[model samples]
Target: MLDWLRFGLGTLLMLGGLFVLVTAVLGQFRFRSALNRIHAAALVDTLGILLMLGGLILLAGWSVVSLKLVLVIAFLWLTSPVSSHLLGKLAVTLTDHPEREMQVDDPSLTRDVKEGD
Candidate 1:
């Protein structure tokens, strides 16, 4: 009975992750702005990987494999947001008008972005 419950929970988590990833992919195409696309990519990197890995960990049942999965999740959690922020910054930097892609609260950034910095 416990085994069945574990399997079911794992499957559900994996499915939810897959669904999040698929929607993010769709959002990438739907959004015209690079910043929007980056947001979608971030969602895939974070929530999608997290859910799928969590399910894998549950399925692995506290083994060495599960520990490795947890490590992978931790590594990704540390790296994904930084990468996403960099990508968004690059998008804003490269665009002719960063204000169009995203709001520049800092006057310094607004000036730099307008100048294509």
Candidate 2:
């Protein structure tokens, strides 16, 4: 009975994580701006990954492998936000007039976009 419950719970968690990741992917494609895309990427890196790893840990039970999974999740929790912030900073630095850059079809920015600005 406990085994069945565990399996069901773990499966649900894994499925939820997959759903979150898919939503993140869709968000990335829907949002036209690079910064908006970063928001979607960050969701996958943090929440989606955490859910996936949590499900794996539950499926593995209280073993060394589970401990390692916990460690990995902890590491990701610690690093993901910092990495996202750095990437956002880099995007801001590299792009000129980011808000204006959001409008891809703007004729005035056509040359700038072609130049990879």
**Evaluated with lDDT, which candidate comes out highest?**
1
Candidate 2 Cα outliers beyond 4 Å, as residue runs:
101-117
**Model 1 lDDT per residue over 6-89, tens place:** 999999999999999998999889988988899878967699999999999889898999999999999999998998988877
Query: How much does candidate 1 score in TM-score?
Result: 0.85
Q: lDDT tens digits, residues 12-33, model 2?
A: 9999999999998999899887
Off by over 4 Å in 1: 101-109, 112-117
Task: Report clash pairs, candidate 2.
Answer: none
In order, candidate lDDTs are 0.86, 0.82
Q: Give the C-alpha miss distance for residue 12 in model 2, angstroms.
A: 0.4
Best by TM-score: 1
